[model samples]
Target: MKRYISIYSLLIVLMFGMVSCEDLFDQKPLDSTPAEDILTNEKDAEALLYGMYAYFGSEASYGRSLSTMLDIMTDASLASTGFSNQLGQMYAWKINPGTSEVGSLWGNHYGAIYNATFLINNLHTIEGDQDNLNRIKGEAYVGRALLHYNLVRLFAKAYDQATAATDLGIPYRLDYEDVTPSRSSVEEVYSNIVDDLEEALQLLPVNERYDEETFTLDFANGLMARVLLDMKDYDGVIDHTSRIINNPAFSLSSGQAFTDMWLKDSGLEIIWRVGYRITDANLVAPGYNFFNMNNVSSPLLPDYIPSDSWVNLFNSSDIRLSTYVATAATGYGWTSKLVIKYPTNPDFASQVLGMNMPKPMRLAEMYLMRAEAYAYTNNDEQAVADLDALLENRIENHQGVNISGDALKDLIADERKRELMFEGFYWFDLKRMGKGFTRVPQENTSTANDLSISADDYRWQWPIPTSEINGNTIIKQNDGY
Candidate 1:
């Protein structure tokens, strides 16, 4: 039988070649009629959009680098002593432009952005059902904005009111044709992100149109809350997150439902997720690396284990300890404690592969965002209420508490750590808060080693891939690379 994959896998053959790029940047994807012919057709237009989503889930994007690599790079998780040299380099804080990891990530995000811009540019000219056209166009806008948002946060300095206007942000590519673009100011890139997301809010259908895998109104708002949170716009964070929390369609998973959320094909709290099929051509290796916790003899056995400091943050009553951990007995012959957030599913045809889908935004994150916003704004009562409500789901007999000042703020921060540990939000959270971290070091000898990362370290801003530098003459490299 021919294996069926997500629409993204199929779209690679359908439209990727249509984009003619002499280098990573500076190319018209649809300069000729062949590309235009595809977009003019309704089904093909939607397929092109699906291609962007597929690229988003690729390892180069959220499937690995954004989620897995970033987790290992932080203090919350570590690379296995036997982890691959490529990943070891990333975890050791030795990231550079020449690393294949950075290059692939850069290509994946921009590739999605390129396709998204292509659709938004061409979709308007076609006459079709207004609502369907709006949804497609809206997805394109959100896709482009999302790619740029991730790029800017990783490549540029955290947004500073004093320096953002002058700081080197990533290029905001808005055109489909080949053009040499220079980095915009951090403020400019953020402004572009907000503009795109706000437009998405106007054009996108409500949560019902989400279909688990597609972007929706709530997703846009959740992302906006995240963007605002990173910008330290507390009121803005509250304003956006409230929209999702109040929505009737979403709520946190609790008890057996939460367990089912991970072990089965369910996403009770997901606002937007990336679709993944077991048969996806690129899915096998990453799925194996993250989900196959039962393999003890494998060299990758200890990868992505929760740090002692991170584990200590949780109380014994925390349900996540059991739900998220792979213990000595359950981890086959492996002895060290490990994370089983993406545990393998016995139900799948390939029982070894972790079949869980990647969720980019969820209701839990929105609640945390709102809680932090409240804490920062001195709304301690409201902040504690939000945290207690979320904790009620994760802890047994959880008694809610009310506190004020930094105590409330610290509680909110710890809540974020416990809630979003391996889903890829830790490093950014520290970066935004100006906090430093120390990696406890891997036990055995490997190319990777333990190191302390301070808030002001230049390494926090990832180097622009060397390949990108070699191809584009007008771009400038980040400092201390």
Candidate 2:
């Protein structure tokens, strides 16, 4: 009655002395060293860590499905006319335990957890530079926390103080053991996520700014802030977010710099991102979910477009409106406004179009999180200041606002939608806010199914994958399917 993950294969065992891939992201082993000789030195440990990063960059994970699926499931985006059926099931609210996207997301996230836990468990056995080893181990913990956090968010109910203690959560796997474990409570899963981040903060280097490609102290703190916000620990969110805000290394990107951050994947605000090299074999660009352009002259084929209501959320003078949304011909009969947040990076256009990096942690998010937390805590003045600061950077000729109470809170929520759209926060934001939405037909697009989902719908919690339930008898399926 143990949980099982089909991560380790004979080829992987022979090739990398750990989990090897058969169909998992079609990835190859980073090193061909025999399983028995793996983790014998510093290089081996780093190789294993790299394998975890590869999983992060896979289409099954952040590279595409994780973000795209969550977005399309919400009202913020709709399937375009003559759209490819990519994630159409999720967008239409027709997913079940047997859905392919569900199964892939479940398995891929667990695969990442396996890699992180393997690296964490074995890294200490290798003698290396103490500082470097600590940093690697720290990154592994952060990866584990991130993977589990995503799993719980997708598979379990949104964290509710009244019900989370009794609600089921995904297994918080800590080691690479072949033991079957039952799902933990939602509260327990969130607690473990925070614990992992705390460990990462201790081990990660204290620096002004770490490379955006690597996890650092700021990344750990930023993640903790997000986790705390989810748990409704407003004070805790303020404390962690303030740490990153005060640091001189990070600032909000504005004007042309902000536009380049999305198009070029270069900016001062990116705290950490899943980076991709043009030569990498598994390179599924995040933008491929939204639009595709073979060349500058080619017509854009957008699989999904922002909903009319969502498009209307941004003000005309807001920089995000111009930077993120663009109207283009779909190569079909109609033209539509496309989400260009992950547009092609000019540097890699010749090799791979739409190959922008996925920025999971950013400085902009901190201000939004802090503003929400402050509003909840009755710190109206500070909340408004945060809102003003963020708006000043995002809007052209933006004026400061003076507001408090529920009005300020409402503004913060809308601001989050405007600022973080398409980066995959819509559905989850709706869930945590205890709100439901209806997807109405857009003026130009009649393809929207007009789906209405309530806050109390069982579908809010995605069903545990059928394969997982069948493989691990001890596991319980989500209530709906």
Candidate 3:
């Protein structure tokens, strides 16, 4: 009973219109207003919806943990010697049901879900512009789907056609009611995600020039493409990616433009990015885990540095080599290659360090997903075309490659690693592809030890939080927890 009480604390806080002292929800506490009267007009609904987005971008979600966890958990990066140990437990693969990070992540995601659900359930009661109302409703649906999609991927086994129906997934919360529900199957959760995305497409405006912060038609399609890829629906992946690829508003960034994208957080390739402002309370930069700039002379006090093997994968000719990786002496003796992907945005550099916005969906990923889907469907010509198209934008003087069969699939996987490393995708790719890897110790770092993770390892599916297990009578823990 005590365990159950805490599990619903976040939902109750949201439902009661109370805001935390830390401003975690980024909204004024409706201390004077009744919870039932909070969403009495369009203005109230809009505020609620914006608050949901704020929480989604909070450190507990994409601003930090969700964006960097899997990257550190796998071989993409390693904790440096004498590091701050911010996510050291995850870096060492020492996770359990009682881990604080796991619980915080779980609570944060559900908190955002509750906000979205509340707006979705009550928005219809208020009268407003039909278009405005629809837009808010649509964005809420997309937000819910996006949160659940990430939750399912992290908590359940990789979507296996034969086993997905039985695999436990995080509960797909759709209402504001206080009820403890059993975990849904991976298949059911995914089905709900798809339905939400499809519903978003119908209600969201069809403008190509939508704000990077808002959910748009392109964002919904791009997300659907990603979801379909994970489910191994090749035709569906291709179909959805093609819609975004054909849009002229989004194009792959290259050369100086590409470098600026990471440093300044501006790019045409970005379909949806969480916007972070300097004025926001308790702002946590997504890239701070990789590169925390202390001062001009040393500048880097990174919690995690790029793994040697991953750094070796990039060629000097590739623009990503320069943009993503930089060598700097820590003033502690040794010079190491650091992940500078999330360096300070120029506008906020004076006030903050390592403050770039998180770009979750990009045009480059669309090309990668389409290429992989094409390869699987035996469309070798189209697959190579898509691969070379992306490579040409990324690699300098890139000559086109003629490859097919397993070779094409391998190339696509490698390219994904190169393009998306540190932004988070390493472990999930391994899980879905049924592959394992060994982490070799980095130089001069006793903390960096050799660890091999097998595809069949139970740790691939994160343990359900112990609090949830104790609170919800029907919730089952993942295997080996």
Q: 1-481, model 3: which lDDT tens digit per residue? A: 0011111223344453333312322332354465568888887786677667766566667777777767778877777775776777777778899887787778677767767777777787889899889988999999999999988988998888899899888888776343567788999999999999999999988864557877888888888988999889999999999999999888898899999999888889998787676664135777776655544345566777888889888888999999999988774567888888887787767655567788888899999999999999999899999988888988999989888899989989999999998677777789889998888888745464578888888888888777776666667888887
Residue 464 lDDT in candidate 1: 87
TM-scores for candidates 1 onward, in order:
0.92, 0.91, 0.91
Candidate 2's residue-wise lDDT over 1-481, tens digit each?
Answer: 1111111221143333233222332232333344446668887676666666666676777777765567777888877776777777888888899888788778777776766777777787778799889988998999899889998988999998999999999888775343557899999999999999988998988873447777778988988998899989999999999999998888898999999998878788998877766654224777776765556566777778888888899989999999989987777778789888877887667754566788878888999999999999999999999999888999999988877799889999999899887677878899888999998877555454588999988888989887777667778988868
For candidate 2, the 10 contiguous residues with the lowest summed lDDT are: 1-10
User: Where is model 1 more than 4 Å wrong at Cα?
Assistant: 1-8, 15-22, 84-86, 281-300, 329-334, 347-351, 442-449
Model 2 RMSD in angstroms: 5.3
Off by over 4 Å in 2: 1-36, 293-296, 351-353
Candidate 2 collision pairs: 2-180, 3-180, 17-35
TM-score, candidate 2, is 0.91
* TM-score-best of 1 and 3: 1
lDDT of 1: 0.75
- Rank candidates by lDDT, best first: 3, 2, 1
- lDDT score, candidate 3: 0.78
Lowest lDDT sum, 10 consecutive residues, model 1, at: 291-300
392-436: candidate 1 lDDT, tens digit per residue: 998999988757899888988888888887677888888878887
* TM accuracy, model 1: 0.92
